[model samples]
Target: MLTFEHDYTRLPEPLWLACEPSGVRAPKLIAFNEALARKLGASVVPDDETLAQWFSGNEIPSGAKPVALGYAGHQFGNFVPQLGDGRALLLGDVVDAEGKRFDVQLKGSGRTPFSRGGDGRSPLGPVLREYLVSEFMAAVGVPTTRALAAVASGERVARQMPEPGAVFTRVASSHVRVGTFQFAARHGEETTRALADYVIARHYPEAREQDDPYLALLECVTRRQAELVARWMSLGFIHGVMNTDNTSISGETIDYGPCAFMEQFDPRKVFSSIDEGGRYAFNNQPAVAQWNLARFAETLLPLMNVQGEEGVELAVEVIRGFEAHFDKTRQALRIAKLGLAEDAGDTADTLMDALETLMHQGRMDMTATFDALTHYAEGFDDIRREALLALTDQPEAFDAWLEQWRAAPLLNDATRFDAMRLANPVVIPRNHRVKEVIDSAMEDDFAPFHTLLSVVSAPFDESVEARRLAAPATDSQAVLRTFCGT
Candidate 1:
């Protein structure tokens, strides 16, 4: 028997709306993460038929208390006072065998007060995309929400056209967001303080021991966001939307709408069809994260210091730390990717910058470029170098960076191949490949989707057949824009 706990209900009543997921028809199991289910300590895994019913919100489990969380976000630089979980329901928290707590929620469950006159359901494509990408992120060691199960609703939703409706079971550290603090701040000082205390106790227990716990919480969240976004940039993952509400206070990547991995490396890449001004572009992620953190810091001011100006000054100091933290983290990542030692820091940075310049100028495939370097480290230099040189119009620039890297003392390491393999994944969820999955699923064929998921699950492992997935898309296969599918 699984016990469901309602720790979130202890918060202020206005923070959420008590509700149950609207039932779906003919719910059928699409995919299940059996490993994750066992990790969550389910003694008996239900049959697929029964599992689908529970995940689709057609059948409630024992001791479940569903609710829709409330929050406010600055959407594309404009503050929206109210935006919350319109179609998602927090079923309850489940404690794993390892004693870690995770919120188990059903997205596309149904309508709630927070729906804001919109349909509270998710399209099939987005549901599968989130499941695939989130699990892929986890496999690659990125902190992100995990997909537990996906269920077909036997219903269709109208987006750009008629699309199948589906429900996704998501497991997360917590659903709390920077916008949650923003919501508390709107209610006044006491509410914000209470929220700070609660978040500190739940996520940052060390903060409670600090002389100024709220400030510590601010700094902790700041550093985590810095590290998280830096990793995203290193992996060429472009989060199309970085709104305050979508920015998880827990620092795990959440809300994978319109998100994509770049085929050709470009700092100004924008995949979200809705982002007209390129506010959340590939290179702008770190800056946008810092921008969101500033909003978060604004909510912490009342609790940081009694004097208003002093609090603002303190918050500004913490916000400034984001740049230093991001630069250090991103640089360390680049060093590792290039198989460099501590002494090669400057050289690694220069090599990375030069490579990025060459890639951008030559329109090189991001994942392939990194993957080829791993082969080069494994002593396949001649073939890999020739292949890489063929892709670049700026052969001189590429040759220059290669020469600098070749001379670095770090190249003497005997385990360079192992190190580079760990740093560079063999495969990512390519846009063309993911589109292939969605197109097949739309035709009620899920073989392509399952195969793609399996390939991405072990990103670092090298397989002959899987190497085909690493290939860059052709001009006809390129996907320029991705939709929210709301």
Candidate 2:
């Protein structure tokens, strides 16, 4: 039997509603993360039927206290006072063998009070997408929620069309978000204070040691968001929906809806179908993140050491630091991607800007270009150099930048090569490939899905299959828009 702790439920009742997962018909185990299960100290090896039943909400596990968490969000810059977990339930918390707490959630487990007239279910396409991309993110060393299991409901959900439904088991440090505090603030300052205390105790324990824990909490959350967004930029992963509620306080990439990796290096790329305004474009993530952090800081103003206008000023000061924090992390990642030493200095910035300009002008494939650079760093070969130059339309311009990069001061070829290999991935879950997997899975053929997952699991490895998947989409195969799959 699995064990659970209900620390979140101990908070004010307004924050969550005690609930149960809606049972599904013919729950069949589609995928079970056995390695993650063992890591969470799950010893019982139940049959597939039993596993599916438990995960699909056909049967609740022992010691589980399911609840639909309450939170508000800014949807595309417009504030929604109440936008809770419409289709997800927190089935309590589990502490792994190493003593780290993780929230086990059931997505597509049916409707709760939070479901605003829509079906509280997920299409199998989105479930499989999250499973593949999230696990791939973990493999690539990005902080993200882990997929524990996926079970087919043997039922169809109504979306743009009728689609197979599945419940996804998502494991995370906590589901607390800036929107959580936004909801709490509406309940009054006391509730907001209580929520902050709970979050600090749960995720940022070090903040409690500070003289002003609330301010420290804001600072820590700001730093984490900066680092998180920077990592997302490094991988060309565009989180299509970056609503305030979807922003996790723990800094892990949360909701994977409409999310896709950029195929071509265009800073203006926007893949989300709903985002016609380009509000959450590829280059705007850092600004959006800082904007969300400002919203979070507003929620904590009442608990800060200062009062009224002074407190607002203090919060603004901290929020303004986001740019510096983001730049520091992003610069380090760029330096590593270029396989340059930490002291590469102005040379790094100039080279990165020049390369990005060339890439944007050439409409080069981001992942392929970076992978080629990684190989070139390993050892300068004519073939690798030609391959890198081929990615850009302006070979002369790129060649000029290439010479500057190669001749930069304090060059150590061996260490630089190692750094590049670690920073650049040989493969990502490219848009077209992900669409192919989803298409195959919808027809009950899961071989393509499993094959893609296996390839992405070792992103750094340049295996034959990995190299094959790294190929960019042809014009006809390009997935220009991705849906939320609600």
Top candidate by lDDT: 2
State in Å the error of residue 79, model 1: 0.8
The residue pairs that clash in candidate 1, if any, are none
**Per-residue C-alpha lDDT of model 1 across residues 430-480, encoded as one tens digit per residue:** 988899999999888988989889999988878875798878899999999
**Residue 193 error, candidate 2, Å:** 1.0
Weakest 10 consecutive residues, lDDT, candidate 1? 404-413
In candidate 1, which residue ranges exceed 4 Å CA deviation?
A: 411-413
Lowest summed lDDT window (length 10), candidate 2:
409-418
The CA lDDT of each predicted structure is 0.89, 0.91
Model 2, position 58: C-alpha lDDT score: 88
> How many pairs of residues collide in model 1?
0
